[model samples]
Target: MPLVNRDQKHYPGLAQTTNYNLSSFKAAEIITRDVVVIGGGSAGTYSAIAIKDKGKSVVFVEIKNRLRSRTETYKDPKSGRGIDIGVIVWYVTPRVGSEPNTTGAVFDLKTGRGLNAPPPNQTAIGIAFQIYTQQLLKYPELDAGMFLPDPAPDDLVMPFGQFASKYGIEAALPTMYSFGAGVGDILATPTVEVMRAWGLSLISSLQGGFLTTARHNNSELYGKAQTELLAAKSLLLRSRVVYTERSTSGVRLVVKTPTGNKLIKAKRLLITIPPKVEILKRFNLTTQETSVFKKFLNTGYYTSVVKNTGLPDTLSVTNFSPDSPYGIPKMPAVYTIGSSVYTPGLKLAFYGAPLTNVTSSLPAKTVKDAIIASIKRQQTANPANPTSFNQTTPTFAEYHSHAPFWLQAKAVDIKAGFYKKLYALQGIRSTFWTGGAWRAQDSSDIWRFTAEQVLPKVLKGL
Candidate 1:
């Protein structure tokens, strides 16, 4: 376990500039920042801000141009927003629920699961949510764009058809069940993992009725983040870190943009992308270590988003896909999303799942149509059975449209030693790691907890 000092990567911003000193060899474009954070998603960016606030210099880089995708906030043309298949957020406090709910922790004994904790109340995701909420509350600037109390849930229930019957919950969700996309196999996997996934889905698989902001869109937070980071020049949007090296001189980072590559030399690195084993192969971790990381990346993910049509208030909604009577996996032309939208505009974002084929890969449109077809079939089938319903039946709704990857599956073995190795990497190459894959599931929780847990350590190490 090698440790990277917090101050390991910072060189004072060059106050005195010297003219070109190129002598056949290029000097590492080394600028000293107390830390180098990678990825600009909620986790990476938030961690950078936390470090910066502590009076440490930091830089953040991301391959994406914007910190957020429209899919994260509003419904995209490609991906509709009926059901928020993404990790539906839920805030938890004793006040949100009745007696017996854990205040600091996310567990809600009444529902037999933690507040949105993945399968069997795994604490990571729930804790991340709690942490993120706490951070936002502390930093009024960040809290401006979010939904506070309405985001928290009182009873965390399992995902069964019972929602329709219980509490008479009427909410529409995207059919990420898209003809058994990882549903069966994931269910077939170990008990705990399946429980976590189901728990997240169950909580998010409802129609609208929760809280939202009054003015800005849900993604305003990302915008707010960009403004803060840009003023500091620590945020690099639309830039990709193509190569990183730990040289005797320092940690060299090559960030690529449309213009060209910019060399950023730092003392440390923090990686936030999903741990794709193949991508990790590019790291300079001796063949053996690189192979291990690549193996972790092999675990994989699936992407999806649903279409939400504003339904009347109090009108509960759910969706089903059609299939042949012979029992082949079927899909609906267009699936419903979120509880019938109380407001206008279509709400097309809900549930997502992992890649089931273990080797199956389809383009977004193909998958979208497949999902739509499955939902259509389910809608037409008898109330008792959707997949096994006769092909002759007609569907409840008919609209063929594209939807985003509501079910983006980032498969992880959690094989036990995975996080151990990741933590080990923290100071080794003078870098850090953050994102849902490391030790979280949603944006808020990961930001909050990581800010407290990782940032302080980063500052101290510096």
Candidate 2:
């Protein structure tokens, strides 16, 4: 509760960086910036750019060698067209000609064209969503925002399957399951937390099909940010925050780069990555800070592009057992939730779980094998197609693991205003937080929240 201005950890000749031994560190490599934004994803990149635009100095740091999430495009041998294996689209406001259909089909923002296929049957889904609307007044903070709302304790702790059955809304499960893609089986997630994580914007996008993708790929957006940040001399790709020194005056981070270790001293620290307790423990966390971070649950997601799948290019695959026809059946996770061809014979696969598990931690070959097995199973199970995979395994073209993501706190912690405490830690030790954990998962929303909410506090302190 004390203002950081009273703390003297930053005072001249005070204790050296307490988390890691500075005696063995090279002080000569120290670099200073007004802000050090970690995790060069949507929020981190946006924050770095925004800070620089404000006429302040900043350095962007990311563990990946590239500025954005790993995106690769494979060229189809026969068609010579690119197949994006990573990020695919952007969620933009619906254009004038675009309109939602009776079936909740999506329309492209630029072209204003609805998808060729109509939306799945969702009449029952609409009835289920009424529960959220009915409870809106109880949580006003979530009503007018793009971010997810803190759930009522009961909804927060209750799993999705139970929540759906309790309200006689089991029909909505499959419709909402895709929203839980890469997170895990929605049936296991806290019902409201899933709603909060995706927020209304994404739901609207799905229902109306207003989501837009970059011309090149999802990486294009990040590429744009990277170019801009590079022009500003604020990007540090392939950087790891090895140690941190926090005090009343500023935050100093020891970042390991491809070249060597460099010290980054900044007035504010904006961390956009999923704050895993193990990762956070690296910083000089007080017991209270550690405890709060430890309360969060982390998810694992792995996405990839593949070739030689040996399946017909025209066939679209969705993973489900033979028994479940209308709902997302309970499983460890949505193993290869869906697969679509980007070009002839080249495809993309997305796999993950709400909890940190081997599905995400396993080697790329193992995951690829599983996807092939699932595809073979689906093909064999289909009475209409009855096609065989020829016992051929798919070859991986690109692999990117966004493991230990979607950090969430317990319902009790959320109701206790965990975010307020999260924000309170902002200026404490001159560190701040952002990204999906603090805001919405979508890039558009994360950028908006960083610009509107996070940067102001950072600037005020600066």
Which candidate leads in TM-score? 2
In order, candidate lDDTs are 0.42, 0.61
- Give a tens-digit lDDT track for model 1, residues 174-212: 222332233332222332222233333233332223343
lDDT of 2: 0.61
Listed in order, each prediction's TM-score against the native is 0.57, 0.80
lDDT, residue 372, model 1 = 48
Name the regions of candidate 2 deviating beyond 4 angstroms. 1-28, 70-82, 95-120, 136-138, 143-153, 214-216, 322-326, 333-342, 354-360, 379-391, 412-420
lDDT score, candidate 2, position 401: 71
RMSD of each: 13.9, 8.2
What's the TM for model 2? 0.80
